[model samples]
Target: MNDLSGLLGRVGERKDILLVVLLLAVVFMMVLPLPPLLLDILIAVNITISVVLLMMSVYIGSPLQFSVFPAVLLITTLFRLALSVSTTRMILLQADAGQIVNTFGSFVVGGNLVVGIIIFLIITIVQFLVITKGAERVAEVSARFSLDAMPGKQMSIDGDM
Candidate 1:
């Protein structure tokens, strides 16, 4: 149990470091040459989702809470599917009209869409599962103690003291 606690402490430290790195990356992007609107939108979306997931990971006290991780995964997959389908439709229409370069651009954009989404979803699920499992282990260890006065029966009073 001590070993497990130490391991969890290490994991928590690593997650804190990663989160700091993520924040630094967001700051770096703010000063880069990229479009400000796009960067802001992406940063806002990522930060909001990260905050919500981090809170969920901390507050939800059981392994079952990890199940919510898949809901986020599923939402991301659906977004990817929508992006893929819409981009495919745009590419096909452009191709039928002989717009070759635009079609190729669309293909390039859509080709990696699903792959990126899959990779991100996998990473997110793994991280959340680690957090949730550690939390569950801690809960299990702490839950072994009981504070009730009686083991199997209530105290009874007799008529005579």
Candidate 2:
């Protein structure tokens, strides 16, 4: 009993363990058929985390302040992919995605399929732009760092002779 308690306490302190579990569970979700209720909860959680990440980016003073953004973003992307696959399976096998998706579909469509398609395209474009902008910023920072290090590297080589 004490050993089990110690293992649980260690897990609580180790974020890597949680991340591993999340990745493993996401893989499992792709193969398993999740009930509509669990899918709804995961969808809501993903949206909430995305919103929080957006807020963090908006308020950050520098890119370095959120150095782990890329890893977090990758994890979220995997999560979204897993969710999309799972949702597709549910729709193909059972023809239902859950209440939130149903509500979103109705609200987005509002009786016009054309309008819904247009809205979806616009949203997709906007998402692509946002992701590309972040990628560009990361590239810029990396280039600047490389340039800044060049002088030090040159000096070291010159001194070695």
The numbered model that scores best in lDDT is: 2
lDDT of 1 by residue, 18-79 (tens): 55665555445433433334433443564576688779888988969588687675554443
Model 2, residue 115: C-alpha shift (Å)? 0.7
Model 2, 39-92: lDDT tens digits are 999999989999999999999999999999999999999999999999899889
lDDT score, candidate 1, position 124? 90
Q: If candidate 2 were superposed on the true structure by all CA atoms, what would the RMSD be?
A: 3.4
lDDT of each: 0.57, 0.95
Query: Each model's number of backbone clashes?
Result: 0, 0
Candidate closest to the true structure, highest TM-score:
2
Residue 119: error of model 2 in Å?
Answer: 0.6
Instruction: Candidate 2: give the clashing pairs.
Output: none
Compared with the true structure, model 2 gives a TM-score of 0.74
Residue 15 lDDT, candidate 2, scale 0-100: 83
- Give residue 108's error in model 2 in angstroms: 1.9
